[model samples]
Target: MFANIIILILVLLALIFSISKWRIHPFIALILSAIVLGTTLGLGGESTISVVLQGFSETLKWIAVIIILGAFIGEVLRETGGAFRISNRIVKWVGEKKLPWAMGFTGYIVSIPVFVDVAYILLQPVVESLSFKSKRPVLYLGLSLAAGLTVAHTLIPPTPGPLAVASLLGVEMGRMLIINLIVATFAMIGGILWVIFFLKNSWIDYDKKLQDIYKEEQTTTHNELPKGNWLLDIMPIIVPIVLISTGSFVTDNLSGWVGDALGFMSIPLIAVYIGAFIAVFQIAKKDKKNKVNRLVEQAITKSALVIMITGAGGALGFVIKASGIQNEIVQIFSDFPFLGAMLPFVVAAILTTATGSITVSLVGTASMLGPIIDNFPMSPEIVAAIIGCGAFCVFHVNSSFFWLLNRLHEVPPKVLYKTFTAQSLIMGLSGLIGVLILVLFGV
Candidate 1:
């Protein structure tokens, strides 16, 4: 058992090294690590191969369609000017003095369907505009935006990171959403407030190049298609959540075919599928059928890589289970009661800090720890929150989001370390605190 633990540790290190230092694609590294783990741990060739295939297919079966639907919705929103419309109206409603708060909430909404980097890209102009109008430091609003995106990216479903983590941990989407939203609120508010207080009087300069690009973006914005109505724009985001949650809660209240029908309608796949068509309807209302067709194609194309990577992460997870190492660790953790609560968080933080990718961090840590963690006494929601918070903490040099924010303005990396990094750390810890509070209440 001790020997198996050492093997597990070594393979994990190798996996990290391959991604961080060797630049191996994560899909490839994960697959290779699974085989190596199964082989060294006495599963032998055939058994390991079976476990690999089993893991990949099983994991994908649960989430592949949901992911595709999610990607489809995100693509439609991106192409249809839906996200822009939502945020634009938000900007008007909140007005200038509240721009930081507005940008933060806009980020929280837009990023639910959109990737964090892509959300940042879609909203950057608005964030910049908000900062200028409000007369606030760029770092202030920028960090607020980052804060929202980071929280949703790590904690919310259908944005990939938390979605995949939820599936790997055997968590239902409804439960994940309910618990994570509460925890994410804590994170988002903490980040927004930190930046609000800290950078209130600070002045930061953008690089000349970024400043010129900003000026260019404002004047030459696209005008080819109509933006979705800000009111109708949120349908795609809300439909799935309402359906899934209703399915979770209402199935118990109603019985017979009616209940079953509602349950079927609420299943994530059907709900998201319906949401995609709602997105199509949005495009149809604009008389852009051709655009509608193209968006579906784009969603199919884009979801392919995410699906493959998620499947590979699953394969590695299954192989870890097959190796007996997971059981070994579970027993060891049994002796250290607190390990149950903190292990997932620590694993996630280490991987995110190492790889600079929250998706990878969430996937890798969840895949490895999910099965073993079932042996722990923590609730699934608490585990998910812990992982989400861990993934957000220590957002320093290794992260792409850090660099994205750095390039947004002329803020030196050193200064960002003090500002943006500091904000993420506070938000992450706040999330952890929120989870502990839930645990105290016996959630």
Candidate 2:
């Protein structure tokens, strides 16, 4: 027992160090960690290989489909000028004085169906336009948008990270979604206030380097398609959420009807795919030339990469669970009187900080804590919220989201480390406090 505990701790530390300090890819690092964990725990070479392969296979089943469909939907939206139409309509409705708030709202809504990085990329031109017109630092508008999107992407369900955690822990999606929306809203407000407070008066002189990049981005125009109605543009994004939420409610409350007519009608994952199909047809039919083939090809290509990455993270989590290391760790943590309640959050934060992959953190933490929750008198909803909160605590060089911000907004490495990193830390800690309070109240 003692030996296994030591090995587990060592494996975790090594995984973190390799990714954070040595700059190793998380996919490589996770596989290596699985091998070391299996070997140290007395799983033979063949067994370890089998375990890893099985893990990968199991994760790819559902994750790959969801990610691919989600990505395809996002790509179609971007190419069809759906995102631009939505942003422009939003800005016009809210007016320039309230554009920051509008951008924040847009980020929160759009990011539900789109990946964080892709959503940011889609809205970059809009933000740039606002900055140019306002003659203010682009970082202010960019960060506001980023905060909204990141909070929802990290904390909300139906997105891969939070959904993975909730699924592993057997938490109901409806409950998780309720908690996620509440916490995410608070986190977004905190982030927006932080950005506005700091960047409101700060003058960022437009450097020649940035100007050149901006000019280049402006010139790279694709085919000009007709501007779709704002309602049509926004529906593709909202349909998935409505479907998933409805499905979750029915499945949880009306289990007898799950596969029955009403229950079959409510399956969220199915809703997402159906929504994707609708989005493709709607966007493609509007185009005059080779619409069907072009839309299908674009959707397939765009979704493939994200789906692979998500599946890889899932496979890594499965290996960890199958190794028995997570079970042992849970037992050890559960024995502690005070630490047991806090174990999920702490483990999640540590894993997230180390792997720089929220998906990995969710899988690792949820896998380890699953048994603990079953044995203890705690709400799985609280456990899910804690894990979600911990996943955003630290954003550093290892995190791709950090780099996305730096590259997209032309933020210097130093500024990113100072400002964006600080904002994440604050958001994370505040979330932790919220979780801790819930735990304290035995909620």
Candidate 3:
């Protein structure tokens, strides 16, 4: 038992150091962690190999499809100017006084179906436009938007990170979605308030180049498209969520004819695909080219990269389980009085901080803590929330989102650390506090 515990600790630490400090890709780092975990727990080579392959295959089957379809949808929205149109209308509705809040909300909604990077790129031009018009700092506006997108991408469902964590813990997606919305709303509010209270004091002088572009909007090579209907643009994204939530509600309560009918209609994945396809074709028809096909191809390519990285992380989790390392760690935690309940959050935070990938943190957390929860009588909701909350803590250099803010928004390192990084830390810590309070009350 002592040897096993030591081995688990060493392997986990190594995994953290190698990934964060060494700049190793998560896929490679995860595989190495799996190998070390398997060997430490005395799993036979053949069994370890089988577990790794099976885990990758099983996880990819479900995740790959959703990601691919979602990516295609995102690409289609981007190419057709749907995202830009929607954002512009939102800015107009909210007016300049609440522009930060409006931009944050736009990031939150758009990120549900779009990749974070693509979402940022799609929306950057809009923020730039806003800055030019208002003569305000683009950094504040961009950071507010980044905060919204980051929170949703990491904490919300239908995105791969939280979805994978929910699946690994055997929690329902609908429940996860509901909880995610609650947590994410708080996080976004925190970010928006930060922008209003703190960033408003700082003045951002507009660049000469941006001023030139703003003046020549009509003659510029890229002209803004006519504003599209906000309802039309938003409906495609919301349909799947509404259908899934309604289905889950019916199946949970009614459980009769009504429930059966709703179940038949609830098919979320199908709804999403159908919605996306319609949007793609509609945009293509209006434009008179095969833009839809090109967007689909781009989405697929992007989705492949995300799928492979996530699958590799899943394989690491499976290897840990098969090798008995997870069980051993669970045993160690169970022997402690208060540690079992807290272990999930602690380890998840550590992994997330080290790896800088919430997906990897989720995989690692579920692997180490899922069996622990199974050994206890804790509520799965609480456990799921704990995992989700834990994954949010400590957004630093290891995280891609960190570099994204620095590079894309041109936020100085000090400002990035102060605003974007601090926002993530606050969001994560607040989530954990919320979960802890619930756990205390036996919720």
Q: Which one is best on lDDT? A: 1
Clashing pairs in 1: 206-410
Full candidate order by lDDT, most accurate first: 1, 3, 2
The TM-scores, one per candidate, come to 0.93, 0.86, 0.89
**Where's the lowest-lDDT run of ten residues in candidate 1?**
216-225
Runs off by more than 4 Å, candidate 3: 203-223, 253-258, 264-268, 286-289, 335-338, 375-378, 433-443
Writing each residue's lDDT as its tens digit, candidate 2 over 1-443 gives 77887877788788778877888766777678877777778888888878777766765666556666766677777777887777777777887787677888888877876788889988887777676666557777887888888877887755777766765677776667777777777777777788878877544544333455455335322113355776887776777776666665665566454446545544556767776767765565455356656655775676665445445555555556666665666666666756766677788889877777776777767755664466544688877887777877677877888898777765777887767777777777677666666666756
Better of 1 and 3 by lDDT: 1
Candidate 2 lDDT at 69 equals: 70
Clashing pairs in 3: none
Worst 10 residues of 3 by lDDT: 216-225
On the 0 to 100 scale, the lDDT of residue 251 in model 2 is 57
